[model samples]
Each structure stands twice: as C-alpha cells, then as structure tokens.
Target chain A: MNVGIVIVSHSPLVAEGTAQMVRQMVGEEVRLAWCGGDPDGGLGTSVQAIIDAMESVWSDAGVAVLVDLGGAESNSEMAMEVIGEPRSARIRICNAPIVEGAVMAATEAAGGSSLATVVATAEELSPL
Target chain B: MSKTMTRLTSEDMKALIGAMQAAIAENAERLTALDQAIGDGDHGINMKRGFDAIAADADAICDKPTPQALSAAGMKLVMSVGGASGPLFGTLFMTLGKSLPEDFECGAFADAFAKAVDAVAARGKSSAGQKTMLDVLYPVSDALAAGKSVGEVAAVAAEAAEATVPMEAKRGRASFLGERSIGHMDPGSCSCSLLVNTIAAWISAKEHAA
Candidate 1:
C-alpha cells in the first residue's frame, strides 16, 4: 500500500527539517507536506497549500499528518474538514512525539504497510 | 510548582510511559482543542504520536538503566518527531538522560529534572515571561530546583500552566498571532503540565512500591 506523510508546523524550518530527516530513513517513498510558513512565491499561500499538496499525493491508502504545536493541529483538522469527504477518512492525524513518529512512520512506509499499520507503529513510540 | 518526590525505578518509569501514552491518547481531542484556540491545533495529535512511540517501546526502554533509557527515548523524540517542540522536549529528556548518573539515587532526580528544564529553555530560546512552555516549566523546574516536594511542584506547575491563559505567545507558532494568542492557554505549556503531573505520580508510585 502507498503511504503518505505530512508534517505541519508554525515554522517551515521544522517541517522541512523533519521531512529531510525522514527521507534519510525511508528514502523517496514517503509523501511529504508542510502546512504553514511565510508565503514566498509558490511555497504555499495558506493552510490550503498543505491540503492541496496532500490531495496530489493521496490515494485510497490514506495519509498521516504530523503537526508541530497547538494551532497547526487545529488547522490540519480544519483542512481535513475542508478537503471534503473523500480524502479525510484516509488521513490519520498523529500527535505523538514528532521525531519518534517520523522514524516509526518512515520505517513502516519502507516496509510497504497500510496507513493503519504505520499508525500503529508510530503509536508504539508513545511516551506514556 | 515545585514538588520533589522519590526516584523512579524501571517499573515506575514504565508505568509513566503508559500513563503518558494514555494521557496523550485520551486527551488528543483536548490537545487539539487547545491548539485550535491559539495555535496549530495538532499539539495533542503530535504529542500523542510521540508518546505512542515511547509507550510501545516501553519494555525495551525500561530494560536499560534509568538515564540511558530516558536518553534513548529523548533521542527518538528529537530525531523521529517533527517540530520545534519535538526537539525542545527531546532536549529536555536528553538532558535528563544525561544528568542521571548510572548509580542514580532518589535525591538526584529533582536536580536532573531541573537541568532538563534548563535544556528545554535553551532549546526553545525562551524565558519565563515569554509565555511558552517555559512559563509552565519554569515554575515547576524552579520548585524542583529549590527542593520542593513532588506534590508541591505539580501543584505549582498546574497553577502556572493555568496562569498562562492570559499571557501572550512570545515564541514558536503562537507568537505569530501576537495579541490574538493572549487569552488562550499555551498548548505546549499545558502538555508540559500533564507531563510533570504524570512524572509526579510515577515517582509517588515508585516510592510506595519501595
């Protein structure tokens, strides 16, 4: 199954950094999306930019969205809502420790697992 | 919020791992709610993911000595998780992991915890008034540093966390909102409170078990 990963944060640097880090583990198989950042050229205009990116990479397999802090989660939820009915169900939003989740997700993606499998793998890293 | 408690054993730390996992999972909605209020709304979700990874690895994590286990977990958080808070929180754990001596004793946990908080402050580039997790964590760490009881520290931490509601966001994502973020409680601060609270309970349990 195809797996997609999205990283959302107030700082684009954090998102970019996470995606880059994940790439080292999972290679090019993971779909990467960054939520909010300074609008410069085609990077993204609003949260919707992230949503659009998500849509482009999405398939029936679903996507996992990882967010940085408070509002990013809310915005992702809103984006899921606004992304309409079809794509929302496939998306799983994980609030675990960012680094751990990325590692788990990356590993599972490399293994060619479903969204549920990857989500389960990520949860195993929970702090308690 | 300073309350010094006993040192945690392997079992105690495992329990905390479980509690933290459950807290993040059960309160995912609340975390999202808090984030939605002032910031990105994924604080709960992101934290929950991080915790899940930690908890799932609990057996292997607890198998090691206290500090090593904590450090390993911290590294996982820093490398695996994404976001400023990820590295910040990860740094806190990593500091704790390092500060903990191989032959750790009850008396040293508080000092190590305080050091961990200092690391968080450094990583987040925040001080108390800036109204980030530092606002909540500082009071707790200060209490711990001052040799307060664990219960005492948790109480103060909870209070400080609640007090953050009126403060403006001065760092990270919420900072972008300026005045808009003032009335809402900082999500990172809130999560830190939960973490401190859970840690306190874990120590208490360990003490009783001993």
Candidate 2:
C-alpha cells in the first residue's frame, strides 16, 4: 500500500472538499481519508476525528496529514501522540495548504513514494 | 468562598483548580467582549469549555504529582479548547510539566516557566511584541526568572495584557484587523492573564495562611 493522505480542516466541508481534490488527482492509487470540525460540528478541530481519519488511512508506507489552520495542525499533533509508537513515527503533518498538500501528497504516494517523500512533495507545494 | 481559594495543598489543589476554572467561567463575558472587537468573539467560550473539562477531572488531575497534573491539564485543554489556542496554551502547560520538578519550587519553576514560554512561542509560530498571548507570557517568564513573587507575577501578567493595547497586531486572527486591532485587548492575552492571576491568588493566600 502507498503512504496514506489525510486532510484536516476547521470546517467539515473544507475537509471533504480537499479530499475530493486528492481523490480526483490520484484516483484509487493511494489510501485517503479526511476529518474536521469538533465533536459538536462546530468550527474547530477534533483530536478524536483526526485519529479516526489517520487510522482509516494507515499504511506501512506511513501517513501524511495536511491541515487548513492552526487548531487543525495542533489537534493532528495530539492525535499523533495518541496514535503513538510505530504508527505515530510513520505519520507526518505537512506544512502546506490543506487542499494543495493533500493532492500533492496523494499524487506522490500514488507513485509508491515513501512517507517522507510524499510529505516533502506536498510541503513543497506551498508554505502555510 | 468559591470565589477564591484561601490555601494550596494536595487537597487544596482540587479547590484551587476549581477556583481557576471558575475564574475563567466567571469572566467569560468580559473575555468575549474583548474578542468581539478584534477577534472572532469565541475566546471566552473556548477557554471556558477547556477549563470546564479540566474541572470535571480536577480531583483526578490534582491527585497526580504536580508535573503530571500540569501535563494532564494541558492534554485536556488541547482536546477541548480547539482553535489555535488549544495547542498554544497546551504547549505552555505541557512544557511546564516536562520541565518542572515533581514538587513545585520557585527557582526551578521560574526556569520551567521560561521554557514553557519558549514552547508557546514555537507552537504559535509567533514571538513577543506580537499582540498574541506571547506578549504577556514573555514578561511573566522574565518576572518569574527575576524571582518576582506570585502576586507580582500576576500583576505583570495583567499589565502585560494591557500592554497589548495600542500595539498593532502581529499574529493570530486579531492581526487581520491591521491597525484596528490596536484598541481592544487581545483575547488570548486576557485569558492567559486571567489564568495566571487565579493560580497566583490561591498560592499567595496559602503562603499567608502558613
């Protein structure tokens, strides 16, 4: 399996929209998932939701996460801690825009790139 | 009175935590007012939500060692607070937990607090002189490292938060206002000072009681 790509954003629609872009860009070549919004569907990020997304897209090739804003990134970081150990070490949070990063990471992973390469490819898109 | 706790101890930590949480809950409107002018007007609600979660586990968190309790509270905040604030404030408490002794001591506490300030800056991707929480945090860290009393530190936090006024924003949602962010107090700074004052009041009262 290729490195997985997960999209995180403060808005649920934004997360799903970004995932749509990634899927359109790379099709079924790379595993993918997306999550956003708080438990109550508020304008915030949820650690639980992020962890669930990460788990859904987990692969030995590792996972790459792209976030739209600060809370999204931080909650994803907390999710990493919760994931812990072997899986956590494999995951990387890309410092790029959620939509662009997810697409680029998915495209690279579809080529069977490693986690680090996929992250670097996505982060190379734009600095956020 | 639940308005304030008069002592701090193993048992007192629960009451002190309650007081701290109450401090945020009680001032939620004031904080919301401040944010309404410059930010998204959710700082008060966000902070209260996090502190309320902390209150739910006050007994359990306080039962742990001081460092562990701080760390636990930090984790709680990250999961509950949300926004950029979740990680920023979370870094502050978590770093303190990592850097402090099992028991709290002023000298080590000062050093640890300084570390926490640095961690906050790193996590927020901003630094002092920005209209962010780092403005208050930096001076408070300095005051602590200089051996200022808890009361004095509290005062510093209050003053530092006020100091944000008239300064153009350099970071966070408030920064989008440009010069318009100059008048209102930064919501994050306000909440940080509120928390500092609550903790300090209880500690100082306990010292006087002894």
Candidate 3:
C-alpha cells in the first residue's frame, strides 16, 4: 500500500475542502481520509472520527496526519493511542498548516516518499 | 477540622461532574468572548459540548472507580469536544484517571494531577506563561503539590487565569495573533480556572455535608 494522508480539522467543511485540494494535487492512488466536526455535527474534531479516518486510509507504507488546530492535534494523539503498536509507530502527526501541509504531504506520499520524508516535507512548509 | 477525606468516592466523582457541568454552562459565553479576541471563538461552545457529553454519561461514569470515572470522563471529552482544549483537557483528566491509585490520598491526588498537567504540557508542547490552559493548570498543580486546600488552590488557579489577560499568546491559534493577543484572557485558561473552581466548590460542599 502507498503512504496515506489524514486531515483533521475542527470544521467539517475545512477538512473536506482541504482534502479536495489534496486530491487535486496528488491525484488517485494516494489514499486520503479526513475527519472533522463533533459527533453532533458542530465544529470540533472527534477522536473516534479521526481514528476511523486513519483506519479507512490505512497503509502499510505508513500514514501522515495533518491537524488544523489544537484540539485536532491532541485528539489525533488520543486516536494514535487507541491505534497502538507498530502501526502507531508508522503514523506521524505533522506540525504544519493543515491545508498546505495536506497538499504537500499528499503529493510527497503520492511520489512514494518514506513516511519520514512525507512528514519532513510537510513540516518544511512551516517556514513558507 | 475533621480529617480530610482522602480517597474520592463515586459519590464525590458524581458531585464533581455535576459541579463542572454547571460551571461550564454558566461560563460558556465568557469563554467564547475571550476566544473571539485571539482565537476561533468556539472555546466556550466546544467546552459546553464536551461537558454536556460528560454530564450525559455521569451515571455510567459514577458507577466506576474514581480513577476509571475520571478516565471515562476524559474519553468522552476527547470524543465530543473539538479544538485544542478538547485533547489537552481530555488528556488531563485521562492521565489523572490512569495515574491515581484506587484509594488515593490527597498527596497522591496532587501527584496525579501534576502528572496530568505534565501530560497537557507535553501534548501542547507548551509551558507556563504560554497563554494557554497551562497558564492556569501549572500554578494550580504547584499549589496542590504544596499541600494547599482545594479552596486555596482554586484561588491560585483563578489568579493564574487572570494573569493570562496580559500575556501575548505563544502557542495555538492565539499565537497567530502575535502581540495582538495581549490584553485578552486566554479562553483555555479561563475554562481551566472554572473547572478548578468547580472542583474546589464540590470538595467544600462534600466536606460540609460530611
């Protein structure tokens, strides 16, 4: 499997919109999933929803999670805890702008970059 | 004074949840207003959603041991609340739940709370004076370590929360505001102080009842 990308945002629209941009950038074959909004459909990220997204796009080549805000990062961590093991080790939470990071990371993953390369590629965007 | 109730009971946990729910409900608007100054302006709404989940599950949570109850509450928050505070606060309670002993004493409770606070710091990659929830939680953890009463700890936490009003946010969305963040209270710190205050009030009421 190729590297996967997960976008976590507090707004469902933001997550979906970012994923749309990433899809346009990376094209098909780069598995991508997005989680946003609370269980009640309000603005907030959900741990279970994030975990579900990660699982949906699970890749043996590893996964990179880009979070939009504070709660998203923390919730993603909680999801990682639930995911556990070698798979958890394979996943990384990149500290990058969600929209740009998703685009860059998805492109890198599409190029079959290593998980670390994907994460580094996203983090490098921090200075931009 | 009678000996302090060391170990928290299920009843105490229920009371704490009740108090927290009430506090969050009361402060939601103020929290949102604070966030409007430097953040996305949803801290209060997100917190209310999280606490509402906890309140909904209060009966189930109160059926567990104190540690498990707290952990469960944290899980609910993590699942229900969004934004930075959700995970940070969720980890705080979850870590406290996981670290405390089954029959914990006050000192052990303090230790567990400190550990939870540390987890929050690590999770946020932040520390005191960062204009985040840590601004309130760190000092409150210290007061707890110093063996302060719950009321005194609440006072210290409130002061720390107030101290954030003058700070330029260094982390999270508020950091995006740069120097503009100064003069606005951090929404997370405000919420944290409310939680601490509610816990203090619950403990006081419990003591009075006993």
Candidate 4:
C-alpha cells in the first residue's frame, strides 16, 4: 500500500496551494489532504483540522505530514495526542519545507513506497 | 512570612487560576507591544484567547481535582490557542497536571514543576537564556526547588523576565531578528512572570485573610 500525504500551513490558501502543487506533481494516485487556518479562519493552524486532514488521507502504509511554519509543526504534534496510539505511530511530520516536502513525499508515495521511505524522501529536502 | 503548603484545596487552585487569568488580561496590551518589536505581534491576543476559553469553563474546571483541572485547561490551550505557544504552555500545565500527586505538597510541586519546565524546553527545543519563557521558568524552578517562599519566587520570576531584555533571541520568530531582539523584553517571559506574580499575590492575600 502507498503512503498517504498531508500538507499543513498557517494560512488556508497556503495549505490549499501546497496541496494543489502536490496533486499536480504526483498525480491523483497518492491519497492526500490539507488543512490550515484558525477556528475562525484566521492566520493560524488548528489541531482539529490537522487531525481531520491526516485521517482523511490515512492509509495502512501510514501518512506523512508537511508543515509550513512553527505553529503548524507544534499543532501537528498536538494532533497526535488526540489521535492516540496505533494509527498515530505511523504518522510523521517531515522537517522539510511545506510545498517541496509535500510534492516530494507524494511523488515517493506515488511510487508505492513505504511510509518510512516516503517520509525520508521528503525530509531530505530540509534546509540546513 | 513564608508559607509551607501542605494541602492545596480546590478553592485555592480556582482562585489561583482566576488571578492568573486576570493578570494576563491586564497585561495583554503590554505583551502585544513587546512582541510587535521582535515577533508576529499576536502573543498577547493568543494568550488572552486561550485564557478566555479557559475562563468560560472555569466553574467546571475548578470543581475537579487540581491535576484534572490543570490538564483540562492545558488541553484547551493545545486545541484552541493555534500557535507555538499553545503547545508550549499546554505542555507546561499538562505535564504539571500529570506529574502532581493526589495530595499536594511543596516538595512534590517543586519536582513536578521542574519536570514540566523540562518538557517545555523539549517541546520548544530551546533552553534557558533563549529569550523565551524558559528564562523566567528556570529561575522560578530554582526558587521552588530551593524551597523559596511564593512571594520570593514571584520576585525571582519578575526579575528573570526583566533579565531577558539583555539577551539575544535564540528561538522562535524573534530569533530571526538576531541583534535587534537583544534590547526588548521577551513576551513569553513577561507572561510567565505575570502568572507567577499573580499566584504569589493570591497566596499572600489568602494568608493575610487567614
């Protein structure tokens, strides 16, 4: 089974735009979703939305998340607490840039790669 | 003059929470002004939003055991705050909630607080002298561990918050400013001190009343 991918950003438009790029680059085969914005659609990431996105694209092969900023990463980590064990063990947040990482992970997932492999492939794009 | 806390009642805990909430509200604008100089300028608004959410359910939260109430508030912040601080401060309270014993004691509180501060450092991946809340937290931890009075520790916290003004930012959005972040007080540190002072003031008030 192919790994799933999700993109997270602090802005609604940024999340959607990144997801768009990932979809266009990796084709429709890779399961994918994106979420962002605060509760009232302000410029902030929501842990609830992140959890929903990850579950929306969840696969037995696992899901890899790409986050745009600090809030996205921390809130994504908080999402794991809500998601609990078993299913959460397979979810990983790549430390790479949101857009590049989502595209790269999706590409790897498109090749039917394992979650570990997909996450690793995307993480390789992280800046020093 | 120093109080050795043996039994912390739910009533006292609720009052502490109330005082801390009010203190945050009072200094909201100050926090915003500080963050405006070095960060995205939403620290005050975000902190108030989380505290306001907590206040909305204060009655029920204060009715629970201290640990449960703290954990509930921490979870509220984690889910609702929507920023790096949400998780950071949430970890602080949640860890304290999880670590504390059923019957509260000063020594136990000191240990739990130390562990909570360590969790915050891990969550932020930043340590003391980083011009973050850890700056104030570390001093408060030290004072608590040393069995300092709440009033004394509160003073330490205030001084620690002020001490951050001379340090350059090494974490968070402020870090990007490098040298420019040196002269300003850290917003997180100030908020941490606010909570400490509020708790101190509340305890003193209760002691005087008794």
Query: By TM-score, who's the top model here?
Result: 4
Which digits, one per residue and each the tens of the lDDT, describe model 1 over residues B4-87?
Answer: 333456886787888888877887888779988877666676677668778778889998888899987875554334444556
For every prediction, compared with the true complex, DockQ reads 0.04, 0.58, 0.75, 0.81
Question: What TM-score does chain A of model 1 get?
Answer: 0.85
- Give the TM-score ranking, best first: 4, 3, 2, 1
* Residue A30 miss distance in model 1 (angstroms): 23
Among these predictions, the greatest DockQ belongs to 4
Least accurate stretch of 10 residues (summed lDDT) in model 4 chain A? A38-47
Clashes in each model (backbone N, CA, C under 3 Å)? 60, 0, 3, 0
Q: Clash pairs of candidate 2? A: none
Candidate 1 versus truth, CA RMSD in Å, comes to: 14.5
Interface DockQ of candidate 2? 0.58
- Badly placed stretches (over 4 Å) of model 3 are B1-5
Assess the local accuracy of residue B116 in candidate 2 as a C-alpha lDDT between 0 and 100.
93
- Which candidate, 1 or 3, has the higher DockQ? 3
Candidate 2's C-alpha runs over 4 A off are A84-89, B1-8
The A-chain TM-scores of all the candidates are 0.85, 0.95, 0.96, 0.96
Model 4 chain B: ten consecutive residues of lowest lDDT: B1-10
Candidate 4: tens digits of C-alpha lDDT, residues B71-94: 998988887787788999999999
**Against the true structure, what is each candidate's TM-score?**
0.61, 0.90, 0.93, 0.96
